[model samples]
Each structure stands twice: as structure tokens, then as C-alpha cells.
Target: MILKKEHIQELKNKLLEKKEQLLKESNLSHSIIKELLTEPSYDEVDYAEVSSDSYNLNILREKQLVVLKEIEWALKKIENNTYGVCEMCDSPVGLKRLKVKPHARFCIECREAFEKEQKNSR
Candidate 1:
């Protein structure tokens, strides 16, 4: 099915909002990391806790970076007029799926198949 201009604009707006939120979160994560670096740990327990928290923060930052990249890719797709097209199947992705995951590169069927393949491979 052909996507309507209004729907495309709505999806774009949602993507833009998500991108802004992600940027803010990323900046906050960086600031927190810097603050953590400056603070000194007093004892072994404190050091261990700090280390664990630092590790968790690093993981979260990495995840945010990945999501930010996905968002950027989605925006590019919007600009290219291929926002809701599945990369793998070359089919229009469902509006509901797109609403839930605007950065998705595949339709639900393709995504589920891909995930199953990955799970089996693992």
C-alpha cells in the first residue's frame, strides 16, 4: 500500500522527536560519566560499586549510540521516501509496526524470520 503524505509527515515528526530525546539522553550520559570520573572511591567496596556503575553506564551509552545511529538512518530513509519499506523483503512495513518502531529496517515478518535465524545460529 502507498503511504499517504500526512502519515509520512506524522512518522517523520515522531522520528524527529525521538532523535531529539536521544540526543539529550546521550549528552546527560556523557556528563554523568565525566562526573563519575572526577569523584574518588574511598574503599574497596566503594571502588567496586563505582566500577560496576561505570560499566553499566558505559553499556547504556553504547546502546544509546546505536539507537541514535538507527534514528539517523530512519531520518535518511524518510528523506529518500523509503521510510516504511522493509530492507529485506522490499515490501511496505505495517503502519502499526512503524508506529512502534519507526527506526525498523524490516517488516514484522522479515524481522521475526531474521531473529529466528540469528537465534538458531547462536
Candidate 2:
């Protein structure tokens, strides 16, 4: 089915909102890391806690970076008039799926197949 322009616009807006939120989180994570680096621990336990917190924050930031890239890709597809099309089969990704995941790169079938392939490869 052909996607309505209004629906596409709504998905675009959602993507933009999510992108902004992720960027804000990324900046906050950076500031937190900086703060963690500058603060000195008085004891070994305190130092260990700080190290753990920093490690977790870095992981979170890395995840956010991946999402940011996906959002950027989606926005670019929207600009190119290719939004909501599944990359694997060149089919509509469906409005429901797009609403749930604005950055989805594949349709449900393709996604499931891709996941199965990855699982089998492991």
C-alpha cells in the first residue's frame, strides 16, 4: 500500500523528536563522564564505583550513537522520498511498524529472516 504523505510526515516528526532526545542524552553523558574524570576518589572502593559508572555510561553512549545513526539514515530516506520502504525487499515497511520504530530498515518478514540468519551464524 502507498503511504500517505501525512503519515510519513508524522513518522518524520517522531524520528526528529527521538533524534533530539538521543543527542541530549549523549551530551549529558559526555558532561557526566567529564565530571567523573575530574572528581578524585578518597578510597579504592570509591574509585572502583566511579570506574564502573564511567564504563556503564560509555556503553550507554555507544548505544545512543548507533540509534543516532539510524535516525539520521531514516531522515535521509525521508528526504529522498524513500521512507517506510524496507531495504531488504523494497516493500512498504507498514505504517504501524514505522510508528513503533521510525528507524526500521526492514519489513517484519525481512527482519525476522535477518534475525534468524544472524542467529544461525552464531
| Best-performing candidate as measured by lDDT | 2
The local distance difference test score of model 1 is 0.71
Q: Would you give me the overall lDDT of model 2?
A: 0.74
What tens-digit string does per-residue lDDT give for candidate 2 at 1-122?
36898998898899989977986878855455334332222111112233577787877775676676677788878888888899879999998999999988889999888777766765
lDDT of residue 74 for candidate 2: 84
lDDT of 1 by residue, 14-105 (tens): 88898779778878564554343321221111122435777878777766666666776777788888778998889999888888988787
Residue 79 local lDDT, model 1: 82
Output the lDDT of residue 27, model 2.
83
Error of 1 at 118 (Å): 1.9
